[model samples]
Target: MSKSAIFTGLVIFIIIALFPFWINFGKTAPVPEPELVGKAKTAKKCVLDKMDMRANHMSLLDEWRDSVVRDANRIYTNTDGKEFAMSLSTGENSCLGCHEDKSKFCDKCHNYASVDPYCWECHTEPKEIK
Candidate 1:
């Protein structure tokens, strides 16, 4: 009697908890695959490794910003001991240098993630040549 009642309550609780997952199981948006163009394709490198950049690029850029502005240090040495200019939208080793096409590379992932990064509030967005 009570055992059956408890079992039914447990089943009900689980169904309620997983209702959203069941409804949206196969309806998720596919992950964005940002395409590289220009220097990025040839260089095949970045200030950090690919996975690290994909996960924590914002944090890395923040550190670079603080270092350059506060300490006047404008160099970034990656794990491979390659040095880069700690810049956002300038220099050949900076973000925009390799990622020239903001629409193809940056916008795809940023939009897919629904992110409106404030980096463009001050930095000029690269002109889309096409």
Candidate 2:
């Protein structure tokens, strides 16, 4: 009887402790999907596969930074055997080259994920997010 009472008490305590959480469950904002526009759309290609990019973009960028700055390697070969400049410059083939509209293309998903990547600190936000 004591064991049963203790288990019941524990269960009640747990429910009470989590009641606030339960009340707000499933109330989060829906996941945001960033859309490509302008050059990003017409290119019909990305540095990696969509799923892979979505999961590992930060890792890929970190690797690119190290390679470009430390090793002076600026060529990135994608899994599809395509080569691209590992640059964040505003050239016609760089990161900002394609993703011209940071607000729509990058910020949507980044904001939804609550991340503030430092990419901007070095590369600078687009002068006009064009």
Candidate 3:
């Protein structure tokens, strides 16, 4: 090939290879690892750690209430601490909302996990599987 043609081809190849590097230059600064910047509160730590744990279905609801709903109630200062669904009359949000069947899903999973949920202490039902 002619020297001029070869040089032109080489320049094009170099530009094509380096184009990505230059185009991304302005926004390509390495994102530094997120700093553990602030002093996390003990409650926050507990909540975060609890988030990592695998909770049985029943315990999940209770944990959700304690870690999240209760915190929301505290922060929002709402009259109703229990954020039950509109159809729910007893406990905050019907168990059937997620588990479908208390005995079938909730009890089965909890029993398999060897967890006796304390949910019965505060809530009761008509023994009707809805």
Clashes of each: 0, 0, 1
- Summarize candidate 2's per-residue lDDT along 1-130 as a digit string, tens digits: 6999999999999999999899989897677778888888888878998788889988998999999899999898888898889987656778878887788888998897789988887687565544
Preferred candidate (lDDT higher): 1 or 3: 1
* Clashing residue pairs, backbone N/CA/C < 3 A, model 3: 84-93
Task: Please write out the lDDT profile of model 3 over residues 36-130, one tens digit for every residue.
Answer: 21232212321223335244433445555675454654221214353433221143334343233456544654665577767667665435724
Best by lDDT: 1
Query: lDDT-based ranking, best first?
Result: 1, 2, 3
Question: Which TM-score value belongs to model 3?
Answer: 0.32
Model 1 TM-score, 2 decimals = 0.73
The lDDT for every candidate, in the order shown, is: 0.87, 0.84, 0.46
Candidate 1's displacement at residue 93, Å, is 2.0
User: Could you tell me every candidate's TM-score relative to the true structure?
Assistant: 0.73, 0.73, 0.32
Name the regions of candidate 1 deviating beyond 4 angstroms.
Answer: 1-30, 128-130
- lDDT, model 1, position 25: 87
lDDT of model 1 at position 1: 67
Query: Would you list the rank order by TM-score, best first?
Result: 1, 2, 3
